[model samples]
Target: MPRSAREPGRATVQVTNHRLARLPDVQSQEVAPRTTPGSGPVVDVEQAEAALVEHYPRLVRLAYLVLPPGLGRTRRVLTAHALVQRALPRRRASASVIPAQAAGGTDGGGEDPGYSLLRLQVLRTALEAGRPPKRTAWPRRSQLPPLFPQVWGLKLFPRSGGAEELALDQQLSALSGPARAAYVLRGLERLPEDHVRKVLSAAGVTRPTAALREASRVPRQDALLESPEFDPCSLQARPTDLMRRRQHTKAALAAAGAAVVCGVLLAVPSGGWGPDGAAAPGYAQNPAARAALDPAKVTKVPPTAWRTSARTDFSVWPARGGLTGDTALLRRALAVWSRPGGSVQVSATPGTPSGAPAGPPQLLYAGRVDAARVVIFYDGLRLARYAEPARGTDGAALDFARVDAATGAEAEAVVLGRADGNVRYLTAPWVTKAAERDLLEPSAEAVDLGLQDGVTAPLAGPAEATGSCSSWNVLQLTEGSGIRLLTDLGELTPAHLTVGRPGAPGEASEPEALRTWSPFACSLAAVRSQGVRSVNAWEFARQTLPDGSGSAAWVCTRADTWRGDGPRVLAQFQTPGGRYGAVAAKAEGVTACGTKDPHVLAGVLWKSAEGRWYLLAAGSSDTGSIRATGGVTGSADGNLLAVRAAQGAQAGLKGTLEDGRTISGLR
Candidate 1:
């Protein structure tokens, strides 16, 4: 149903320039249209319908962002689509009071009066969806979940984004509905503050000014507003509970049989089956309590599907290994994963949920590796590895690691088994060659590890190495065009290693890249078993020794995990003649040295050759100035800082970026 409106060409009021700049696609016409306090261009039913069709995706995304997150992702997606679809005018002619802004607006440059009306409608409904029901009033149609546009036996939601996007989502979740709308209009729509206030007011926000003030508290990460994490239209789908579906099917059949028997009894003479007063109470089985033990329902991908697939992520990997057809083995693995015994050793990477599979997960591998039977399953988000001895299910082990949105390089290989001092790997089918390289010696040549049916030959695993860490071994896989280096991190999946700066990282196969990794090869130990997706080492700065000894390198190594949270950053100092680099400073769960925030500051106490102690500090090349406070006080104009100090001296380091942002040193 649409709202009734006056005929077209009735209003004659000019909108201010501030409001005019909000629409990106608005064209410069011969005559500027006029608008009143709540009136814009005339929008007929046909015009509004056309606008909605053209910008359906954008409208849905806006609704998804403004809707309250407590509705859950599946419901939020469905509600967003429903709201946008219902945004059309019901009558033949309706005047759109919302005026189109300028071409430089935030929505990637598009403008239409009908689109503005649709946006206002969608925003108002989305805000209404988040409000709690009142006792004395009936819930609005927008407040109730739509009966249409429902998905059956499947769950759909947007793909996850980086930590910054996640943090922004959390921040928005804490704000009020109007505040969230204000933030989205400001960032996603790229509207001026006054324009945002007008739009919010037109969309039924009572306190638009207060909402604007509240949204200003969030950090300005406008680029992340367009991230796929918030786009409900570009979604990933996963099946619902298969076990429950089967049970429901059986129940339906039983109900049909009972109806047939009841009809026969009524035809004979007895009206119907006699009611039993002593019957026990009835209750449905809990889906969570039900075991996902059906081997037939296990998902399996074809062998050659990845060849023509557009995505190069873990979703494209085919089911490999010999025991994939073994229903008994697959059932046991699934059963154990859902409910492991006391003896089963269970470990999950940080931030990874160790819950039971939502439905039948895709089988990546199911076979015997060394003395144990290993089964790997990918359920859209995380990877679950189930391992037990060949003879029995005793002492089974289950490990989980977040692998959402893993690219081809990141999903190149996974550790199959670790036996004695060696480890075996299950490589992707696209991999052409595999080699083992010692990261400690950059000049040493890589030894080829032969591949058999996509499985790599066993090599000495660094996770098994104890005592003094002298040599660090890493696996190099040549997949399609480029090469990738992954090292075992005491987990089923290895961490991909790269060189150079955060945004522009390259393979470590080059001589210069290898040399950059040599000194900090042992630093990988700090991020082991943390579900690290990749680690990058960048030489940010170099300084000449004040003692006239030699030059030293300042390196920043950052470890990014699959979970997109808890990234590890290390700032290291390597003297010219030293064999290994000494760790200057380190901090966990911070983005100091990551791609988003590449600048890093660190300091270390070093002893000169002449028996003098000096406090040496350095920052990334973007540093405009560095200052040491607290126990030690000094300042530097550039990135490097060297000051004479006592041996046990401590100090706080602060750096000012060239962009005028102050950053603190990692500790």
Candidate 2:
């Protein structure tokens, strides 16, 4: 019979025999059709499997060329091997109908036998030959498959298109799992979207909506730039594609630059001088000075002046020595010698122990001596002296001097035995005629020393002398001395002569007396004595009397003194009511302690009459004890004290000069 009239199964055998005779002896395998009838024409499963195996190595080589350099060939081969294995099952299932489907005409109806089984075999063979194993052994240098055009382009033009290659890799990375697989299959591999979705579903990436949103939002530019393997110029693209890529790059760079600038600005200081410039508060102004002060041995504060008395007194000397006692004559002299435009006005208030109001300040004394000197003394020891050689008599200027009795030496006594016995010699430069007149006449209240508590009451007589001697209302006597003052009324002694009530016997109502005393009686010559109507009477005092013959003396005195022409009294003292004579003995060793005015004593040198030096600290409270040398140091809230002993010196013991060393302990 003719081939067309043969059995349906035999027809497929005839075609295969004819094709095998014409073709070369290529290795091939035959596969039996599955029993599931009406599915499609039977196909050779063994042949499809053999074809996939043969082409996998070449596919892996192609994938390796498109991938990053760091992913070794071995890894690429493994990936391709896995992909081929996965594809095999699908290919085998479809192989039965693949050849028949290709050969069948469109006009064939569903019910008709579509194509001969032998025709399906021929089609399958052609497809296998086209994708031979060797085709993927090396990367294709020609047009790349649509799946990874950008990556292929970069390989073709490395330097110019590398950025585009990177961008494509970035795009893939940015896509959600479902979208990434869909894109790889549809856009990259030219698979239909529906087929790509199927592949994604099989891979378990089912969320299609969320994947689409993420893919649209996150830009690929940042990822591309960060990736070392990506190159833009090497990527093959149309003009529009290149422009889009450039815009994305520019936006990313701008953002990065702004972030860097903001970071830098935030790192700088907000206010005041920066590094390498002027320092903050308490730092020295000069660079060299600051460096030296880094390990500073001394720090000095500026001097602060305080008016520390109520009825300030100053001593005045006669410009010529023998001036008339007439008030008018003294006034005329004062007017001529007064500061060019300055006038002297004085007033008096009630004396201590009696609240009697005194007359106003007067032009007691004022006058110019030589061209450079002008002196004014109001009250008694409260003095204001001005010496300015460069300034003319009428020039507007101020040259003030304060006489600190605590620090100043008394004028040497004149010998009354050989000269006039009743006449006292005027020593130092005497106050000018103007100064005397300006001081004596009463005017308005001239100064207010802002005294706290009560006025100082006068004490009478003399006894033992110890502890500190001051002119304020309060006295800080030693323990024994304080007890004596409270018990014995007649033991206290005024430093100067007494001036009683106006109507009392032998009473002239003289000005108040001001004096300084030595608690240890080391020397009586250094103590200051004077007379004035008003006194501050509230000054603070500190005393460091000798503990023994060899011990040092120290004292805390006012830091500043009054500046006036007359004998200026810097400090004063008075005894309490019903008390007489000095309380303590005139021993060689004694010490006293007390607090001082916070403002005036802020910055002064404190030297004890016994010869010890101390710096008067500001705002220190009165405490009456010495820091023990052999024990720990101590301090009050406002002040600190340090003690040091001589080398190998025991507590309360004295050491020789050469063998002595200091052990400083601070409070």
Number of backbone-clashing residue pairs for each candidate, in the order shown: 14, 108
lDDT minimum window of 10 residues, candidate 1? 11-20
Highest lDDT model number: 1
- Give all TM-scores, in the order shown: 0.56, 0.17
Using TM-score as the measure, the top candidate is 1
Q: Which 10-residue span in candidate 2 carries the lowest summed lDDT?
A: 11-20
**Alpha carbon lDDT at 88, candidate 2:** 40
RMSD of each: 25.3, 46.6
Off by over 4 Å in 2: 1-45, 50-77, 85-161, 208-667
lDDT of 1 by residue, 1-667 (tens): 0001112222111111101111111111111112223446556678889888888988999999999999999999999999999989875333444455545764532667778888889999999999998999999998998876999889999999999988999999999999999999888887778888888987789999999999999987878988999999999999999999899989999999999998666545323222111111121134433334456777788989889998887787888998999887887677666666677788888788887787778889999899999989988888888888888677788888888888878888877888777989888879999999999888998999999878899988763222236688999898777888889988777888888888998888789999998878877887877878889999999988776867888888999988788889877777765555666667788887787878888776555666565667788898999887765678999888888866455566788989999987775
Error of 1 at 146 (Å): 60
lDDT of each: 0.77, 0.25
